[model samples]
Target: FRLAHISDVHLGPLPGVTYRELASKRVVGYVNWQRNRRRHMHDAVIDTIVADLKASQPDHLAVTGDLVNLALDGEIEMARHWLETLGSPDDVSVVP
Candidate 1:
């Protein structure tokens, strides 16, 4: 089986609330800052991974934990969209 292994995608091309410019930076919170700052990097990572997967043309794809940084509901959708590029739901399987 031509299997593709991937992990820690953290898909995010969304506009997260930026806190760097805020005067009350202390109130922004760590999670919020990370979410916004990491969005671009995460997005690039996902794009590169997906492109690699497509070029490889694997019969199956596998992903480990941390698929999403914050585990947002929409993150699951983004992951689904990327996985769909492999084939279809019926063709893919996950351990957990």
Candidate 2:
């Protein structure tokens, strides 16, 4: 049986943030995202990986942590949607 392992998706198109949301550690994270992380991590790359994994028909998929950046509620929700698109929770084990 095939088992696929994926991690650190850092899924993005980060949700709109208000100044209030950037009040604490988020400020640091937001700056990092804006300055560096955003350019390197692309949704298209994740899509391509998902497509390839699906085509390979893995029997089980294991996803580790760091699925989202800043850990915002919206990011969690979006990651949930993205995970569903990849596979059911039963088929894909998620740790983040």
Candidate 3:
């Protein structure tokens, strides 16, 4: 079976992150994403990646790392929608 592996996608265009939510180390990650990462990241990038991966017609796909930069509710929901396009849960692996 063919297997395609991708990691550290770091999907962004982050959600409405609040100061209260980032009252810890996440504050650092939030700041970094805003200054540096956001410029380099976009949802379309992930769409292109998924398109290419699908074109390859892999028997299985494995995705790793934090799909959302901030792990916000919106981001997690977005990740869920994106994951569906990759194929069924039986054919893809992201979270454990």
Candidate 4:
């Protein structure tokens, strides 16, 4: 069977994060994403990758960690939606 493994997606343009939410260890992640990740992360690149992967039509897709930058509720939901776009749960296995 063919398996595609993708990790460190780090999809950005983070959600409207608040100071309260970044009150702990998340502060560092929030700061890093705001300062560094946002500039480099591109949805177009991700889309192109998804399109290519779909074209390949692997039997299964295994997605590892780093789906979110800040681990916020919105980020999780965003990850969920992104995951849905990939395939059904039966076809995709996530380690995040």
Model with the higher lDDT, candidate 2 or 4:
2
Runs in model 3 with CA error above 4 Å? none
Error at 74, model 3, angstroms: 1.9
- Please state every model's RMSD to the true fold in angstroms: 5.8, 1.2, 1.4, 1.1
For model 2, name the residue pairs that clash: none
What is the per-residue lDDT of model 2 for residues 33-58, given as tens digits with 9 covering 90 to 100? 99988998779888898888889989
Against the true structure, what is each candidate's TM-score? 0.58, 0.91, 0.89, 0.92
List candidate 1 segments past 4 Å from native.
13-40
Mind giving the per-residue lDDT tens digits that candidate 3 earns over 45-96? 7778878988999999999887877787888898888788788999999852
Winning model by TM-score:
4
Report lDDT (Cα) of residue 23, candidate 1: 36
Taking all chains together, the TM-score of candidate 2 against the true structure is 0.91
TM-score, candidate number 4:
0.92
Comparing 1 and 2 on TM-score, the stronger one: 2
The list of candidate 4 runs beyond 4 A from truth reads none
For model 4, the local distance difference test gives 0.87
Clash count per candidate: 0, 0, 0, 0
The models' CA-based lDDT, in order, is 0.60, 0.87, 0.83, 0.87
